[model samples]
Target: MGAVRKRSSADRPPSSDRGRRIRRSERVPDESGGTGMRRPIWTALAGFLLLAGCAGGEAASDGQGRPDYGEIKSMVKDILQTEDGKKAIQETIKNDAVKQELLFNQEEIKRAVVQALTSEQGKKTLRTTLEEPKWAATVAKAMQKENERLLRALMKDPEYQAMLLDVMKGPDFEKMLLDLMKSPPYRKQMQQAIQDAFESPLMQEKLYAMIEKAVESALKPGQKEKGGEKEKGGEKSEEGGEGGGK
Candidate 1:
């Protein structure tokens, strides 16, 4: 050949490329579960947690109708590690679908959480229920499992599944869990709750020891119940009676 044919850059093999390249079609989903561009996993997880908390109870309906997002935002800020992460949480709180799912009117949920955190009753509840390390761990784990179940359900619907996968690819969904561990406000909150409990006349060291012993006794491996199925039957009777009353 008298003249060498010139090869275009597009014709170059990927293996010879000097810089890394990613597929445009492989970008992560937005907070609303819409896919287009890739985003951080922290962003995705923040979105997921916020959505899950809002969706999991009767509050979703009540919240969607009159959201106190400022409260929700404050709680998230009170609990997350970084400013970037807090911003992501705030943005998630502002999402419309989240609002509708939780029945929170815009930012009302945020305000409610903040209000709860600052209030005596809210602080007491957190101390009584969420302050225990073991219980906090349990609630966190259960909430995560529930969120995954919800995400799996979302994926079963053709459109939503594709969106969720995109979000997963952006960051380790587990990072959110890690961030939660690093939060100072939560640690303080838990410590305060434990202190409150310890101060109670009804919660002396011996009593606390006894309660722990009882719980351990009831949790024996392979046991259905400490008293077996009869206790379970009694619980059902109470539940049934309550339902009938309602």
Candidate 2:
């Protein structure tokens, strides 16, 4: 008879050295995980696999004394679906190391998001969503405060100031202003503003004072105009050259 062939790494069951190591770790602490959580989970898995593989190692063997991968996967899935599995997952997530790992992945998530938004499919989806008036309105309302804050911050930026000045100084802006000024609505608004100004008591007093000053100024100009009598009825003053009062 041929010598009994020694088992290779590929022939060994998952419950071999792995199962024993898992069992050993359960008695000690797992500093990396903040608790011995990983050990217990692994120990449970190893014990299950050991049961299926240890008896002559033939019952759950894929072909020759090795546990089947498909069976292992199905078993893991069934285990994960249990309530205890969910609780274990939640506890594991509470670990500081896990939180740091999640935070560290944020930059990658951001890049993925940007790439998605820039893609054609994402653009089409965005356009469809925005076309819904209710959605558009809700988004606008939600973003209003943020938009205002961003604008306020931008207003303080020197680059933004320069860009705004450049735009206002452009020929297109000048044309736009001229067109706005020429519009009937703009003329109507201007007339309405003038009427409102006249109706205001302060504006009325200011206008009245301006008119009185203008009258006095006109009279002074007239008095200094000619050295001889200019009015129909003239009285020449010997003290100084002056125009006759109208």
Candidate 3:
């Protein structure tokens, strides 16, 4: 019987290696920049208020405190549904910089970010009962609402709306997202890309150079030892026998 053929590279599952080559590139980490918290200040502030308020209540003493999840969800839903909220979002989409980004890299940017936010692993860290979860469900729900809001806002920005519809329907959307994940730049975002990219290009370059220098210095001794081992192995073969005795 003929041996079973192995799956060709193209036929195999997508590579574990994902990058920011296409649409997802913006999401990737740029170690060249300073690392800081990627979370929005308002989110951090609200969390502080939530924890402080909770600490004063009976729920705080429970084995697991019940989150004011309904309140949070309502806030999120309100933000997305209200007229002023929608107007602010539309304004964001209308900003020249944001418009350029949306129009130029809309397809890739959306796919990478949405894929990262909605991925099984991404959602896992974001899951848990609201009682025990630290802003988990709230965060997820807010993101979902925000994305929905953005898509609706896109309708007003005809170029971006067209781009989104082009890539976000049926199988094309799934493939685009999967492609975004496998692309290097985007997967980096899942780790901590946003914080790093929020800086000037020159500063980012300097930071990366420092990191590279540190890594090289740390590895220099180990690399020398490996080089010595290889040299010793070469000498041993020369002192022993040549291949085919020639």
Which candidate number has the best TM-score? 2
Candidate 1 stretches with Cα past 4 Å from truth are 1-106, 131-135, 142-246
lDDT of each: 0.77, 0.85, 0.76
Instruction: In model 2, state the lDDT of residue 158.
Output: 100
lDDT of 3 by residue, 1-246 (tens): 133344454465554444334435665556664223454566899999998898867555673465678888999998999999999999998899998877899789889879977999767754544446557667667799788987788789989977878777869789978999998888887656656664769778988999999999999999999999999999988877865486
Q: Write the per-residue lDDT of candidate 1 for residues 168-206, one digit (tens) a residue.
A: 666676677567767998778889999998898878977
lDDT of 2 by residue, 1-246 (tens): 133344464566677688888887786676667466776898999999888668646544546556578998999999899999999899999999999999999999999989988999999989999999999999999999999999999999999999999999999999999999999999999999999999999999999999999999989877866633554234435323444332
- Model 1: lDDT to the true structure: 0.77
Question: How far off is model 3, as Cα RMSD?
Answer: 51.7
Q: Estimate each model's TM-score.
A: 0.17, 0.41, 0.19
Per-residue lDDT of 212 in model 3: 100
What count of clashes does model 2 give? 0
- Go through the candidates in order and give the C-alpha RMSD of each one to the true structure: 43.2, 24.0, 51.7
Question: How far in Å is the alpha carbon of 146 misplaced in model 2?
Answer: 2.0
Q: Model 1 shows how many backbone clashes?
A: 31
